[model samples]
Target: HATHCPKPFYSSMKTQLVSAIHLQEVELDDIEGGNDPADDKKDPTYTVEEAVETIGFGRFHVLLFVIMGSANIVEAMEIMLLAVVSPEIRCEWRLEDWQVALVSTMVFLGFMLCGALSGYVADRYGRWKVVVAGFFWSAYFSFLTSYAPSYGWFIFLRSLVGCGVAGVSQGFVLKTEFIPARHRAYLLPLATIFWMLGSMLIIVLGMTVVPTYGWRWMIRLSVTPSVVLLFLFWFIPESARYNVSAGNTRAAMETLEWIARMNHATMPPGRLVESAQTERGSWRILLSPAFRRTSLLLWYTWFVASFSYYGSVLSSSELLEKNLLCITDADAEHRVKHRHEEGSVCYCIPFAFSDYQTLLISCLGEVALVPLNICLLNVVGRKLSLALLQFLSAIFFLLVNICTTMLGFTVLLFLLRALVSMNFNVVYIYTAEVYPTVARSLGMGFCTSFSRIGGMIAPFIAQVLMSRSVMYAMCPFAVASIVCALGNFLLPIETKGRALLVRLCPR
Candidate 1:
């Protein structure tokens, strides 16, 4: 008898059956007798070959993960450039501190508000469509944001590009759904590593663009990733797990065969669930006792994290004072002129010219974020690590106010931003893992929406400090960070190595 499925996933029945048949055939004829309770109990038991064939963990999985990670980096570079390019932007436009902050705040605001609905649609229709929309829209608008001639157009375009991030915000969850539960913790961290690489490029751009051509060029430079890395979309396949759950047999086979070919193995033939049943999917299920509380906490966390984060970045731009430093040095303007005078072959090369140092520092900031994320997630539990970082970030915001010297201020500013960057990465991974399969999309969307609300308000908050001392401006973010840090303490579960839940709502 064919097993039944939830109404929402009714379509994936065939894919479910095929994958089941595939797994069962292998279980039935285990060459290594690996399924035994005693032998499988050992954590070290999974041989590299068996991991590839039986469990679907291998170079192929790594390849897909890397591609996804790099895609994330391409997007991140655009985001970080917002912070790096602010100095030139604020100076040229003669804008206030809040105005500069508005650029990134608006982007996140666009992401926050649109995320929930996109999550729902992805759950009902497909993950691939969501990613496709995000890519096309973000890439187009990101380029448009660069071309904006006026401050109003600049803010409008940045927020519009933010809409693109909304469509693709839950990529971690999508990747989580496709892979096995056991490897998820490690996989999530690895995927974020791509974000690190992308951020690093902006740091490189910072070294080259901001000092020489000015901040507008940094905005123009960011357009490279959105256009170039888009080619990967073709190679990116749909979620096999989503396919299996929806009962699409043909799609299941095609995706599985692709996986097999990617790994060089034979397809297994077994039942999809052996006895799994389902009913049509519904949003009501998210409010079930099992998930409601988790959803609420995640939403709140996103709000606080977003508000505090962008608040700091926007506020930091006010602190750059590089132009001040340049004025003090006198020699600085000559340096800028010297580079522009020479031009061309040396221009594109960041390290080739002297003006690129600030850009280099900004781009290198991304590298600093990498190991920080890996260590925190792997060594410390999610809750403590996030809370700790948020708390520290908040402290740095306040400390930036107290510092007397320029050198002292910039050093603390970079360090705190690095710590917060790590926290931001953790929030992405943890939020996705906390949700079950059914609510993952909406959960992500809702959480991001709250984040956008914070993003939207970050500029206003920054505006309050615009007329005040830089030290005073940071206090609000510091305070909010403390609140978020404390709230994280109440997160009920660790979710570090938990399984991806497949809740089949009974009819």
Candidate 2:
């Protein structure tokens, strides 16, 4: 009666796969036909997005929020700290503005180079292992900066500091992966107050202490929080997501059950498939067409963001402009110095200060940055938010050359910075949301590592552009920003509401 070909099964599977594609698209039609969300839900095979759904509503939600937020501030301070102090550091060392700028950017470059290695290490070991290692490593490095022997030594140590920056991405992966999917947009940014907090910390330092004590004291102060946080991390757990990826079904289930208990939800009744154990991890996997496009976008995205972020922080006219004006009143500057160094340890003094922007603009940028970022990220997609900001920043930089009004340019500069502040906050959230649980941190670390190239170039370009005013140096960042916006269309997939293991195609 029935002599049927097997093509029907394949055809049905094909249709289902196609259907999943439409459902999972991050840009539009994301929730997809309002499928019975629970009917499709299963116990053990719960998707990554599903697991994250349970994250923020649970018992330790506030604790996670605080830790993650503090972590963001800590990491932000590390990256942007040097930028904040660039003018002062330049004066102390008798450095060309550009030369002092490299100290910070090179660390980011080092960060870029080591991402793949960090991710590989995360995969080989555990997400928590990397996170803990990174926290402690960076803590010690902070103290080391206080004693940097010379300019050459400072640069080397900064690069070493970048290695720790790479670790921070892995840490973010672990902390972020455990977060509830719904709260991700909010919590991730909330956690990112670290960037501003770090900035504020540096700002406060610069305003009160740095002028008096020395740059080294500010450097020491940067890591003090993380040093304290080392003990605070005592209770944070290893990632259930990572456990699932490593194919430890029992451990994965155990972790989820623990989370359920923490959330006061019933123990879930199914197995959690963290990963399907493909060769999802190698450099070869990264070179595939799908990743190549994404990698290129991420690489440029990282670089342009770094260029804009640090360039504004390190090279602008806000503070240096102030210091230059203040140099004329040597007694006041010296008196500020004396009060700052009251019972201070070191006496490293600048022979004569050079022109540089004060962080007044950056401070303004930070004050307004958070809520504005939240609006853009939550209302607009991550891609649009970042692209628009980057484009605006580049245009503002170019505009500065054309417009001579202090009021007009200052307004533009502040506007430009308002746009740039969104870069790091959204980028972390965006990157975390895009990847699957299995390759999540590794992918993030890799992305961050490549970002270091931008960070590294950030200083060089700012210096060169400041010295030469060639449009090409910084303009490439603008062009690159535009490119990333366009590229988002090709690689756009949202894991926001889907399961960790939902059916979807990569291409």
Off by over 4 Å in 2: 1-51, 54-56, 270-280, 317-361, 367-369, 402-410, 470-476, 492-507
lDDT for model 2, please.
Answer: 0.64
Highest TM-score scorer:
2
- Candidate 2 weakest lDDT stretch, 10 residues: 318-327
Over the stretch 1-507, how does candidate 2's per-residue lDDT look in tens digits? 123648787788779998888666743442454334553463245554565564437666767667756776778778766755655666567675567666776687667777778887886678878877887877787779779888888888878777876786677777776777666666676654566667667666666667688778888877888887778777677777666566666776767677777777764344455454544455544555545666667666776676677666555532233322223234444333311335542223332332123345545665476777777777776777776776667677666455343354456657767676677667777777666555666667777776677667766766545544535455766666666656655555544443333111352
Range of the 10 consecutive residues with the lowest summed lDDT in candidate 1: 344-353
Look at candidate 1 and tell me the lDDT of residue 313.
Answer: 60
Give per-residue CA lDDT, model 1, range 225-273, as digits (tens).
6666567667767765555556664575577677777777655543233
What is the lDDT, from 0 to 100, of the residue 252 in candidate 2? 65
